[model samples]
Target: MMIQRYNVDQQGVGQFDGGKITEQKPIGFPGEGSEVKRVGPLFYWAWAKAEHEGYIPLHPHQGFEIITYVISGKAEHGDSLGTRSIVGPGGLQVMQTGSGVSHEEGFVGSDMQGFQIWFEPHLREALRRKPTYQQFEHEEFHQIDFHDGVHVKEILGDDSPVALETDVHMWDIHINHPFIYHQQIGKGRSVSILVLEGRGRINETSYEAKEFFVIEANELEEMNIQAEAETRLIVIEVPTTVNYPLYRK
Candidate 1:
């Protein structure tokens, strides 16, 4: 299968708090200038960075499995569930907005960074269920550390406490030296790659920081990623086809 890459300029730029906070949206909505609106069950992806401590006011969401992954500093979450908590770097907060839910976010510490992603499931069934929320500390997630300076933290999958109706798997990977991370993505499924830092080569092609790519496979095969610089990236794998009726914008 072939791979496609979108540079930073190809994505959407969002500024809040009078530019105190900025975000790059790889899959933003219309008028956001992001050519890619979505991939399979993956609905949205936003890489947010805080220049100074700030917050986003309460907002509504419905029928989407949303997740926020903290990359640096600290993040605070509050929602209609009466949940209010703070999460440091490497932590994550997930919300399954079955019917509807409202939430607010605040980021503290200098240069705080994180990602907010939304995944779609069978809306009909999800809407019938109640909204749910959960937060995972940095230690609760499963991590694989290699002596070669390669590391992987599974954000989703069997070992993860996060359970979503969306058939997607995600991970945060890092490497400092020449290394290869491998995976076998089943046929008809695609991998969404976000290069958050440094540079690397995937399928023999070079890519630098702030690059977003999608790989579609014709069959199950090893997906090899080789990086030489100190790098950090995110990967989300989802089926190419939707099994249940999906909600359209």
Candidate 2:
């Protein structure tokens, strides 16, 4: 078993609207100074926060699966595909830019926070399809609670409402007490974990708020996440290797 950790400062930074919005990127683009540029198919992951509000004008994207997960407040998404929607807390907005698409987004409410993640698919196959957009409301996802003060909300998986061509699974987890959470990791796979709130330890390694860790496929069968306090987190599980050629930056 092997593990690597990155603190908030170790990640890249970006801002918009005169710094009204700031971002901590764990898997950013080249020259972005992020520790992990691309974890298999996972390309970019940005944890963005809005002090009062912020906006990003229409931008073009191609052959990338972009997702925005709302954490605290709401986000307004407007795209050229005639898709206009507002996703609130626990909601998700996915944009599969096949051939191409132009879209703009903004954060609303005080202290609005969310994550913008990009996943790359097989470029040739993705570009052969049409551009699309999908939005899942806060009530659209399913949640499961265990006996242990732990809860797992399915964001993307076999049973999740959101579907994509990318082979990935995502979840939002929470635990309110000292507990050990275990799971069987797939062979030749990896999991990207981001500590959104509170503190915890993976095995014996301590991790706090806004930390990012990548657990790779290195003979680790089970992962034990031990929480010492009320902790909340997000996890993205993907293959350890991509079958297609990735973008070079």
Candidate 3:
């Protein structure tokens, strides 16, 4: 088991939306200048910040499940499925581009921050289903408040609105003060953490804003995460038994 950690500077950064949107892409598409991709069905993990309102024109995607979580502002979404809506802070938007889909997205405020994660399903099985979309608000999910100044928000889990056909658990944790939180992963499950704001120490290693830490399945154990200050982070735990064929440059 191995734990891999990456700071924001170690990840690939790019500017889009006419340079208004500066993105730190942990994984990106071909020809996009990002090289970080996962194996065994998980393709991309990205955290983006939009300093100003802007749009990414209609683009086509297929054979992937895209999950969007808005952290600060609102994002207007429109897709070929005739879905048009706004996902605000603590809101989630998911699009399963089984066969294929075209969509457009735009930030809605002076500062919009969010995460866009790409998860892959069995390609053969996915192509047999039509594209679909699911939306969920913060209230629709379960929130567990710990006595140690830590709050865990389950975004995609057994009690969440956005259900996936895959075996994955996604959570958002916000620490209002100095505290530690522990999460136990199953034997065959891998865990990944992305820090959104503030600072923290994970496994004796201190991490600041926009850092990502990945723990292999064999390394699954209780993680000691202590917030140096008010901190917010996202965690993804998934099965490591499956192999995902990724597309890269």
Candidate 4:
């Protein structure tokens, strides 16, 4: 299997919320000063941090499933749909902009940290549907405690509050002790590993914080993750086929 690593510093950087929010974007669009967009079917992966309470103005999106996971502090979300809510640490917000939608965001407290991930579906089918939103607290998720030092938390899975029209599986893993985790990717499936904290080895390559490793289905077998510290990571598994055509404006 081929393993590619992307360090945190290699990601594109942007400041928002009057410079209160600093973002590190992986898989950003090419060229300078351009809004980061998806390559292939994946839209974007952004890690944002707020120095203090702040807000991002209204913005429009379509034909994509947007997911936000809070790591720390609180995040307040409001949209044109008249939905307003606050998501604190370990909370999740999923917005499936099947056709189109507009939304705004704000941060609370001295430090706010979170991740915003975008996934795309078949464009033609997506535009035919209406947008929807779903929210889940950390307590609603499935948490597996391996008292032996391994824990697996299902953030989005087969039996989760967040649902997607496409075939995708996402999880957050926390390991406090030494252990090996395995995942089998079927044929034509793609797997991406993003390390949020600590260090780990994937296929013999060491990956540190903010590093992403994308493994192609045809190039690999199962995946093995080993932690060198109390590690936290987000994994996304999806099919390799281009089931959707992205619309860029």
Candidate 5:
């Protein structure tokens, strides 16, 4: 078992639209100065917020699966596929830029918060497929409330409608103070956890908001996380390696 931690100060920072939009990248592109770059198929992850209102001009993407998950407020998307859509809080906008596609983004409302994450598939196969776009409301996902003061919302995993070529599992979790959340990691897999709110402890080590943790196991392992205070986290699990060739930075 291996666990790596990255504090907020150690993450990468970025801005857009003259700083109208600010971002904290847990995993950024190469040379972005993030402690962690690509992890398995998980390429990039940015937690962004609109100070006021912001817009990102159309940009092209190819051979990657992009997901925009709105944490609060609203996000509008316009793509070269002639798709224009808006998703409110707890909604998601997914773009499979299989071959190639251009898209523009707009953040509506003050202090709008969201996450834009990129996942890589087999590039050669992805580049040969057609691009597509899809959207999902928050209620469409499977949410479970555990008796132990833990709530989990499945984003991309079992019982989720969102589908991509990448083999990954994602969840939005909230744990009440003094509660514990346990997770099992299968062999040859890794789990990345990002604290979005509150504080927590893992094996006597404390963690707070904006912190990222990566845990990998060569053999099946179990992890126990206890919430020091009310805490919210996003966790993604993926294979440690793939059979196909990976893009090197």
Candidate 6:
């Protein structure tokens, strides 16, 4: 087992709309200073917040799969495809920038919070496909409650409604005080975690809100975690190695 940790300040930072929207990036673009650049097919992960309101001007992307997941308020999206939509809390805005696409985003309501995650597929194949956009409401996802203060929501995986060409799995987890959570990780895979709220311990290491970590297992393994208080986390699992070529930035 290999474990790596990065505290808030150790991660990359960015802002849009003159700081109205700020981001703490666990995995950021090159030169942004995040300790971890890209994790397998998972390229970028930005946890963003709007203190009051903010907007990101139209930007172009190509050959990347992007998902905007709303955590608190709502996010309004406008794209070159002439699509206009709003995804509220617990919803998702997905975009597969196949050939190319230009999109703008706006944060609505007080203290809006969300994540913009990017996943990569084979660039040549991706660039040949047509760009597409879709939205999923909170109720559309599959969620399970253990009745022991642990709730698991599937964001992307075998049973999830949202599908992508990338080999990845994602979950949003919440655990209450004194409850333990366990996950099995297979060989040749890595698990990336970002603690969104509360305190917890992964194995023997303690962590708090805004902390980022990764666990890579060379063999089959199980992770034991305990929440010292109410805790919320977004977890992503991806292959440790891919046969396809990755972008060099």
Q: RMSD per prediction, one decimal?
A: 1.1, 1.0, 2.0, 2.3, 1.0, 0.8
**TM-scores, all models, native as reference:** 0.97, 0.97, 0.92, 0.91, 0.97, 0.98
Model 2, span 1-249: residue lDDT tens: 668899987899998888988999999877777978988899899999997889999999999899999998899999999888998999999999999999999998689999999998998999988999998987888898998789999899987998888899999999889998887788888999999888878977898998999998766489889998899989999998978898775
lDDT of 5 at 181: 85
Instruction: Point out the higher-scoring one by TM-score: 3 or 4.
Output: 3
lDDT of 4 by residue, 1-249 (tens): 666676766667777877888888875656523243443456678788997777899999887888889989988888988899888999999899888999999877678888888887887888899998888899999888876777787877686777787667888888886677787777777777778888878768898888877777675488888777778888887776665555673
Q: What would the TM-score be for candidate 3 when compared with the true structure?
A: 0.92
What is the clash count of model 2? 0
lDDT of 1 at 229: 82
* lDDT accuracy of residue 189 in candidate 6: 97
- lDDT per model vs. reference: 0.89, 0.90, 0.80, 0.78, 0.91, 0.93
Instruction: Give one digit per residue, the lDDT tens place, for model 5 in 1-249.
Output: 888999988788998999999999999977676989978999899999996789999999999999999988899999999999999988999999988999999987778999999998999999999999999999999999998788999999878999989999999998886887888999999999999998878656688999998888899998788898999999999999989888776
Q: Report the CA-based lDDT of candidate 4 relative to the real structure.
A: 0.78
Better of 1 and 2 by lDDT: 2
lDDT of prediction 1:
0.89
Candidate 3 per-residue C-alpha lDDT over 27-100 given as tens digits, one digit per residue, 9 for 90 to 100: 66655555456734557877778877878889998878899899988878899999998989999989999899
4 or 5: which has the higher lDDT? 5
The better candidate by lDDT, 3 or 6, is 6
Cand. 2 Cα-lDDT: 0.90
Instruction: Judging by TM-score, tell me the better candidate of 1 and 4.
Output: 1
For model 4, the stretches where C-alpha displacement exceeds 4 angstroms are: 32-40, 247-249
Give residue 242's error in model 2 in angstroms.
2.0
| Model 4 error, position 200 (Å) | 2.5
Best by TM-score: 6
